[model samples]
Target: MNEFQRISPQQAQALRQQGAVIVDIRDPQSFAAGHIQGSRHLDNHSLHDFIRNADLDAPLIVSCYHGNSSQGAAAYLVGQGFSQVYSLDGGFELWRATYPDDTAQSPAE
Candidate 1:
């Protein structure tokens, strides 16, 4: 689509189960401290590589500390050619609060 869609934490979880590529745009330290399990950390350094190798048509979920920043990130991903892009509403904080058991520390394997 032309823009990214906003989704609640529950919606994000559902998308995760369906194999969406979830990317966390938060700072490295905060991301390392805690984040959604299976999410990849994406910053300036990794953004290019991630997009270069990513499947442009796959569902992509962008997340941040709060829901606000994710929207812009998601939009950027869409502009980069991602077909189905979603911005996690309430972001990591809400996801953490909603699914406490679904979080992981120190990044994903």
Candidate 2:
């Protein structure tokens, strides 16, 4: 089994610009409050669908509230055959603070 790498929010942002797929593992309410722009919410409810539909080789970045949980999520994704999985180091809080303009609230919320 391969381990996922931990990257700073700035590195994650660079990955995003290169078309990495970002997935937020936070609860629905938290995710609805704000998230990285273009990130997909992949909580327990939607994880299965996402896994089934997502390309296995795509660069996948996982983020949680404080970055801790995202490490586990990133590992899981890598185990599921995602070739390039990364855990965002500072998660949503860091991202929000670092690049507020790159964040977006859930429009459907």
Candidate 3:
């Protein structure tokens, strides 16, 4: 697709269960604190490797602090040849509130 779609937390959760690749674009500290389980922390340093190795046809979800930034990131991923790109509507804040149990924490790497 040439564009990305916006999805609610519920929709994102479903996609997650189905093995969608979820990437968080927040700062390292914030991302290390908590994020969707199995989500990868994508930053400038990792962007190139990520895009190079990702499965373009697989569903991909982009998330940011409150959702706004994710829209732009999602669009960029779509432009990079990701066929199914989605931006989380309410972002990490909503996901944390909606599915607290589905989140994970780790040291920033």
Candidate 4:
């Protein structure tokens, strides 16, 4: 069964306001460049730990560079028992363009 929904950046914003967990599947460098405020970087290396610590039932919004990659990531999260999963329709690029003020640049570590 399809376990995730694909939503626009605007819809994502609304979900975020309601406390949805935003997960960026982009590479660390891309994520570091910019991402939705409060989004966690969840690439392959950090995915396991994230899964272990995350609330499976909380709404999860998955995003990639563009929207294409997020669908799979969202589905995987759902397969792992996440009850609510959403793929950002146009991904981070669209989000950044649509809501520039909603983004945050990650400080160099």
TM-score against truth, every candidate: 0.96, 0.95, 0.96, 0.95
Model 1 per-residue lDDT tens digits across residues 1-109: 8799999999989988999989999999999999999999999999999999999988889999999999988988888999899999999999999999999999355
Q: Model 1 — TM-score against the truth?
A: 0.96
Runs in model 1 with CA error above 4 Å? Answer: 107-109
How high is the lDDT of residue 64 in model 1? 98
| Alpha-carbon deviation at 30 in model 4, angstroms | 0.7
* lDDT, candidates in the order shown: 0.93, 0.91, 0.95, 0.92
Per residue, candidate 3 scores C-alpha lDDT tens digits across 24-89 of 999999998999999999999999999999999999999999999999999999889999999999
Sort all candidates by lDDT, best to worst.
Answer: 3, 1, 4, 2
RMSD to true structure for each model, in Å: 2.0, 1.3, 1.2, 1.2
lDDT of 4 at 94: 95
lDDT of 1: 0.93
By the lDDT metric, which is better: model 1 or model 3? 3
